[model samples]
Target: MKQVTPFLMFEGKAEEAMTFYCETIPDSSVLDVTRYGSGEGGPEGTVKLARVSISGLEVMVYNSPVHHAFTFTPSVSLYVDCSTEAELNGIVEALAKDGKFLMPLDNYGFSRRFAWLNDRFGVSWQINLA
Candidate 1:
């Protein structure tokens, strides 16, 4: 309970998505990664747990062994406040590839521009230009 970190559960792409986020976002990094051992429920070398940061916002991710009927939804989303349109747009473009956009980038009056989507790994995100 030291901190409330956002946790993402990927079916089998936790490591790949973590690496993508680290590379796509500025000032972001992967703090740690722990993988399942050989013959474990998960494939060897698959991420058991991983800690990563985007814009210094620390988040957790892991691969789940059990299948579920549910997945990420726009109802709950990670909201990012960007300093510039370029910053917001850059992230939106990278994330938009192979991702579904809940709301395409537009001036929603509340913000200069905004885009909401569930990223390639099925994590919801809402980016806004302040």
Candidate 2:
């Protein structure tokens, strides 16, 4: 295979999520974005497709035109290996705002500082201090 990338489907929050992730993570940015125009499948001005680079990983985000009963689950998640405690804390706090934590920031045997949470947009994430 040439490459594999993680895909995130958002009903209408793709752009917002991309912005939040890029701002929260150090050395991250939005690489590209395709917005839906008039007559497009998704609502006008909504994200048709977007590529966000978080640290170094490229993640794909899309705004789905059709509503679905399902959404992001904790079974799968974006994992982050933080190099500093400050970075870890900042990320955890930003992601946890208006979100629920599956495992709060604490030592979990494997890592000294670890946090697992579903962000406000329903995307799951695991933050760890390396």
Candidate 1 residue-wise lDDT at 11: 90
Q: Candidate 2 lDDT, tens digit per residue, 1-130?
A: 9899999999888988999999999999999999999998888888899999999999999999999999989999999999999999999999999999999999999999999999999999999999
Q: Which is the leading candidate under lDDT?
A: 2
**CA lDDT for candidate 1:** 0.88
Query: lDDT per residue, candidate 1, 1-130, as tens digits?
Result: 5889988888988888998888878899999999999878898888999999988899999899878898887888888888888888899999999999998999889887999999987888999987
Residue pairs of candidate 1 with colliding backbone atoms:
none
Candidate 1's C-alpha runs over 4 A off are none
Which consecutive 10 residues in model 2 have the weakest lDDT in total?
A: 39-48
- lDDT, candidate 1, at 108: 89
Estimate TM-scores for all models: 0.94, 0.97
Give each model's whole-structure lDDT.
0.88, 0.95
TM-score of 2: 0.97
